[model samples]
Target: MKIKALLAASVAGVMFAGSVLAGTLDDVRARGKLNCIINTGLAGFAAPDDKGNWQGFDVDFCKAVAAAVLGDANKVSYTTATGKTRFTKLAAGEGEILSRNTTWTFSRDVDLAQTFIGVNYYDGQGFMVPKKLGVKSAKELDGASVCIQTGTTTELNLAEFFAGNNMKYNPVPIETNAEAQELYKAGRCDVYTTDASGLYATKMSFDNPEAHVVLPEIVSKEPLGPVVRHGDDQWADIVSWVLRAMMSAEEKGITSKNVKKLAAQDNKDKEINRLLGKDPLQGLSKLGLSADWAVNVISQVGNYAESFERNLYPLTIVRGMNALYKDGGLHYIPPIK
Candidate 1:
């Protein structure tokens, strides 16, 4: 009797999981809006603008997904999540896509039952200190009070880095980037540690950015990307390909200004034509996207390079590892065809 009951439960669970997977695209269409989860506030990544509108690199990625899925870039609702609450909110279904500047890790992908589609930014953990502190290298910061976001890979990385280096430090935990900024600015913490890009962003936000210097050492690899719940391959494809479309658009010299014209004409490059929906690419329909989905993404939200320059340039973030593969960086366009 017990064995029979267990078998029945297993079958029921599979059915439930199947439904959840199949229903994501339908749910987004029926609701007419994409729910995007993002960081609480990280300058140049996922922070609000002067007019109370969310605008940043991650924000542009979310908008691109909305454009691809809903045909309207503005048809997105944003939910801000701190380091501690991000996974819980995503698992609880508070959002359709987690477009936060979240690090892709093993435990997050497997143990948490979340799927990281692909990396949008390749980064490494780094440290920052005020010039007054006179810290040149990460190795110089012994016994420093570090302001770090709680419940993040940064925390574990911090501990491991310090332990490995035979250094001791005090931790100042905060929930959001905004809180960390305030604490660090108020001199509550002697150092700030996070993604190198984040360190640059944080440093740029200060009254005197030159007063703080990001350390020369980069500690851990942080491949940041968008995420979706597991068991949804179709939904995952839609999200993943949206990023791919943007990247390929840049590689093919297709910008927002010219995408519409290119889509209307016959292009010599078959991939460009296929990507712009001038020719059919099999399985776009299977992914529950329109033929012109890539068009919408590039036209409405701009390509990946445009988004990066518009958002991150202000922070002085150089396109080091985030640059295209052809440009001696890590980003590679998965062939659109």
Candidate 2:
């Protein structure tokens, strides 16, 4: 009966693993706060305000998930992680969700055992240089010293772009955006390379922001989004739909200013009613969230447009690829109903 014993032990191990995988929601609920991992300090994406409050495009998504699950957007605790430590912290369960400006890729999704919920920002790698440098294009930087963050897709993209152009340059590797900014400003590197959106954010933080100009060329696509650990289907769905709900709310004209009022009445739009919990939508109970979850998210954090305009607009970041689908952008979301 040795074979029988081995099969029994195997079944027991599977059950234990399933239980662990299924406990993310329960764990958050029990903890009474959602631990969200964010960037150390990437201005428009995730940075502390003068008053030490975390506010940005990525921070809002974490708050939205907190609102949807815990019924309070402010019930989230933030943990700062550098690019090199983000995935390791997530995989180790140090944080429930990683809302840093992380790019989604095949290896991160499959090999690392993590799930990227959806793309919050469509970005591309670009270069920024001082106007005094007189370099208008990235191609002109043949032998330039490029300041790039370590452990990012931008690093790989930079290498490939330079190699493809048959050029060589000195690499000034750094760990954080703030470090890169410091070194670039001190003339340690001739060029600063990162996502185009990030370039704007970095520029805005400078003393004389107008002195720097981002080049026109976008070298590689950077689909940035929120991430969670793999093997938790329920937690993944909850986070995924939290983002989708914000997009759907924007598509349906449900802004934070009017979400509560609209939720009180039965509108002609059945989808709106369903989203605001006037009518029941199936499968939400399985995710262990309330019927008014979408309402909480919309009312607290607002739609995707609101978050972007509030955080990125001040940095002069226009919604190029981040605009709605009907508005000729890539932010199309599936129906909430």
TM-score of every prediction relative to native: 0.93, 0.94
Put down candidate 2 lDDT per residue, 208-280, tens digits, no spaces. 9999999999999999999999989899999999999999999999999999999999999999999999999
Best by TM-score: 2
Clashing pairs in 1: none
**In model 2, which range of ten residues has the least summed lDDT?**
13-22
Question: Considering summed lDDT, which 10 consecutive residues are worst modelled in model 1?
Answer: 13-22
Model 2 alpha-carbon miss at residue 45, Å:
0.9
Q: List per-candidate RMSD values in Å.
A: 5.5, 6.2
Global lDDT scores for all candidate models: 0.90, 0.93
Off by over 4 Å in 1: 1-21
Clashes of 2: 0
